[model samples]
Target: MLLLGAATVSAAGQTPEAPKQAPTFRSGLDVIAVDVQVIDRSGAPVAGLGPEKFTVTINGRPRRVLSAELVESRSATSMTAVERAAATAGPPVVPTLPRVVFIAIDCLSFDASASRHVIDSARAFIDRLPPTDEVGLFAYPYGPKINPTTDHAAVSRNLATVVGQRHVPLTQFHLRPAEIVDLSAASSSANARDSSLLESVVVRECGDTPDDTCRRGLMLEITGAALYYEGQGNAGLGMLRSLLEQLTGITGRKTLVLLSAGMIASDTPGGRPDISELGMQVGKEAARSNTSVYTLFLDTTTTDKFQAQVRGADKNLQAVGRDSEILGRWLDQFSGEAGGAVFRVQVGSGEYAFNRILNEISAYYLLGVEPGEEDRDGRTHEIKVKTKEKNVVLRGRRWVMVPKRGAAAAGTVSPAPGPAESASAAPPAPPRRVVPADIQAMADAFDRGAAEFQRGLAGTRDLANLLRNFRGSETPWPNAPRRTAVFALELAVAALRSDNQNARDEGGRLLAEYNVRLRQPGDADAFECAWLWTEVTALEGLFMPDSAMLLVPAAIERCPREARLHLAHAIISEQRWLRGTAGAAEVPGILERYQAAVTFSETAAEARMRAAWFLFRAGRLDEALALVETRPPSGTDPYVLYLTDLVRGQILRGRGRFDEAAKAYRDALATWPNAQSARVALMTLLLSRGDRQEAAKLAAAVETAPADQFDPWWTYWLGDYRAYSSIVAKLREMTQ
Candidate 1:
């Protein structure tokens, strides 16, 4: 639930894209980017350098320069204004809200010694943050659990408590210095290994496969935490997706500083000795969701041969020392693709270069440019910020654009695999880009397929053509930005919609057979498939038409962890609740599933708010009220708040408090003046009062509104309002 409101928490992982109008565009997302500053043999803040002072690239290609400005604060921007306002007595004081900074304690990678150092570093980090920046804490140990960071006392208190958990083999946060050395000593007990009794607990603890490795008592807590929301049936990838989707919806900049090892949940492609394909998918999700990972790799020294792909390889290169040729190559490639880099500790050269890394961020530059396109599929784009002069060492944002539909990244993109790998297998090639024609054809096919479906003439081959076209278009990563994983999944959806079940069966067989293949994050086709499901399976209703039911089961199984898909399932399940034909027993299961659907959300907001509506339908008022009060509110999302208000009004009405209910409805309407539900409810209540004048007024209000904004619910009440209104108008004509 804490992850619901955290600045960085959001939907992750999806596929690739190309030049075209998006079915939807997530615009106004602000990126709070920071670059680690580097100097020549001499040290100085390279002032007077404009955008031309630096060169930015993604996969070694250049991008246009937007607005390059230093990280100046509001005080700096408004200094003259502040003085002017101070001189003008009785001037209005502008109220400001806190900019949230999430401080996470990841015990999975940190040993006790490192945990303490991180805590101390966090304290210093917090002190250096903007006064307007209020911090929050969370532990993914058991899910993304929230802790208070606003109060310095509370931060110190929580850090102290978390550090004290002691790195038992069960809770690996507190391994002694000697134990860390033991872990550091191993070349790598890489995923698949045979540990002798003489081997330390650490080696024995991480399982053969990466999935099983972090699956131990405390380390694999995020999944267990996922189970919490999942069991409620609201827990799905959509839960996280929706939250991140909402974050991307906002127009603000956020910098998420992660102080942990590179313990990414990667998919070990093709059963090779690597992580699963989902790890990179998760990273892609992170990117599209508008959060770039800034990893502060704790030097526990265990990362010898073990490549932690959680944070990309490019980030790893920023560190001073600690290089494994294989891992270095991976980091260099991964970081370049993902747009962030790593900071390392140079052993025997004093404390790992924390101070130097800090200076890098302190003197960093943020470039704001108008993305040529409006699509937010988060496709990786090359940024070029160069100095007009030579001999000026420079570093700024290397990658800025987030690839949506993570189709084969336009070039050289390598994503982390999901955490299920057989170490003995070979690694897959890096991800590549799509020909301009491929995605254009994809968009065209979807338009034709959807249109044909509406026309009642869509055939299997039509959809199959769409699938074949994509599959033949590009491989995982033909060149740069190599892992556009989403494209393949989108192909699956297109195939499932085929009038051909034989084709679908073949696709499903492939899913079960090659489940890892479709797990690439931000693959252009793949992410779109996931995002499409979120639409098809809205709690408001399914994203696709009821005809879409044919494809729902197939797509759900493809990415079964999707929360959006589950909520869509609950919408179908709600029909049973509506049908008295199913009798008493069926209704309870309907309510249970609906509630479960929303509760299962990884972020907890999307599903829970939807669940509140289900509870009202089930006549569970107290519970609905509780959910509204406790569940995280997505402040920027007026629709969510509007939905909550309807539930609240229903709950109030069900309790037989008509006046209060009416006022609650009115209040809800006042908060959302354009709400169709509130107006329809008002019109109904007015007709019941026999107030023809009032009824007529309400009826005209809705009648004049745009048809696109028309509420179907209003149609039913239109008769009642119009009947009285007609009579009232006739009587008024006689008097006038």
Candidate 2:
């Protein structure tokens, strides 16, 4: 995806660090330019200083300054000048000078409610900007949705679209199935959590020597987990690198204002590695492009007590602390390398941060120095700038990477030596760092719990422990919000399935907390349909079906086009219809909504699967099979695979194809052996076919299986109660 075109040396003779090979410049001049910001004792920017007041040092050697001039932020007329100059480039070559600014919003790395504040504050900053400032607003990987524009209305429209759809969790790119398997193994030997059956599947999938597969799998798994937990910041970092690449040919000051909660730390406490190469890439590019990257950590503070505990305060502060450490290290390295200083703003002080950036960019002095012949010895020259005036402090780049002699003629820059290429190569990269024993154990426990949940093989306690351990250890923020939310809802649902008093209480509490937050002024308007679904799901998970049913009208009014809301309504309606509280005439309306939900949800595959399940339970065998067949045959998700197979069996059984239904159930069990639905269905199919011995064996396994793992709610909903009661009677007889 990173396509490198004909490499061009900047007018200042710098080449960015290439991804693979070392790069050399092809410039006639050896000028090195650094953007400097100087301020007096009172914290005000010091301007109007001449070239004579400063000294430049490189690689322990002093260099003479060629030019020093203040590049104050200019008006829109100056921006037009740069456009004209770019238009007349190649031969006549009029130099272009425009202050370019990029504002990247990190929607993936912050809470949804808090992100509203970030967007609003950013809008305020944009409104106050002078017409001269051509600003580009980006929502992480998606866009500048509106590119650098001086038009206020354009910015508003683009930003509104961004915030309007903001609550949808950004989908993480899926790793190849083979890669995910290997990644799990490499996370920890103990954490592998795979049974003998799964191991056999992996071996079969690889179709080669298991030893080689194991080795490669280990390497890939570590890398994959790092990528997984890092979230969308991965894409944001890529865009930042690409931005630097684009800025290379442009002339004059460039600034990128990165607004977000913050990126995850490379040294994050868990064994998860930092897969992002952005910090290093950004630093090198910022220096080469003479651009400053100013990060604004949006203040995510809230006064609502329930919101604070459930969605806001403690978590936001934790993010601040984590990002401060991460940003301080990387931002300082890149911005300082580019002679731009980083500002860590306090909560509710986004305006102040913007002001600091404007002040620094508007009044900074641009100084240039011509490197000596020795400076081009194919090594980096460390540059330091200082002033003699009392009470005046100067800030700028401390070093520059210079191309080797005639390496310029090659017209490419090789990647700077990584830790491996350096003398410190003896130590493994952080991603390859050995996962600690305790960390590994915790990871294994989490995976085991997840596997148990996936197959309906877990009890209430299993889910409770997993949820508690996850919250206590991993501490989701900026990295794993979606993952956390999903797990929380699952645990609450599992509690309701088992009739666990404490678990149901926990589920009710989560719904109550979300409901209180939703009722706050303007909160309902800002709520994403996904958030609404979470609350509805919690209500269902707690067995408050009537309460969940009551929420449908308001939810539909709020997000009229949302398919998930319709799906939720369908589930509630179906439950009532089965309980005989609703008429058969109501079924048609419910079916229409199910069809609508399948047609409109972004996660259409899941919606379709659910719709198919409902139809199977309703004895609409042909319709269920037709619906399931429409979905793509391949899926990377294990849960989806299991559900697809299980539903196919149910439909087959309804059609009286007992043998084929039996095969389908076995296939589903093969996909997820601990799947209670598959086991129960297979047992009933055997009984239907008069295979009593096999039926009795399966019934015995079901009786012995962990109590929390089997959810009678789903069994009843799926409409297999006759077979379910028969199996129970058989188990009771054998026990008695």
554 Cα displacement, candidate 2 (Å): 23
**Would you give me the overall lDDT of model 2?**
0.52
Cα displacement (angstroms), candidate 2, residue 76, comes to: 14
Query: CA lDDT, every prediction?
Result: 0.41, 0.52
Per-residue CA lDDT of candidate 1, range 379-439, in tens? 5544544565455545433444554443332211122122233223443332332544544
In the range 1-736, model 2's lDDT, one tens digit per residue, is 0111113223224564343332223333455555577777444556545667788887778887665554445332323445334323311211123356777765545555555655666677666666656677767544344556668667866665554222221111223222233344344456543545335434554344545434344344334334333333334554556566665544345677776655433543233324334466566666665566777764332322234122312234454344346534444555655666666654445666676666555546656566788887755556788876579767665547566655551112222243234434332211111344443444344445545444542522454444333322322322544433444444445554555554443443333223322332232442335556555554443444444554565667667776656766676667655554444556787677677776773546655776787778777878888877543356535565677777778887788787888888897787777667788899988887799999898899888888667433253343222143343233223222
Question: How well does candidate 1 score on lDDT at residue 539?
Answer: 14
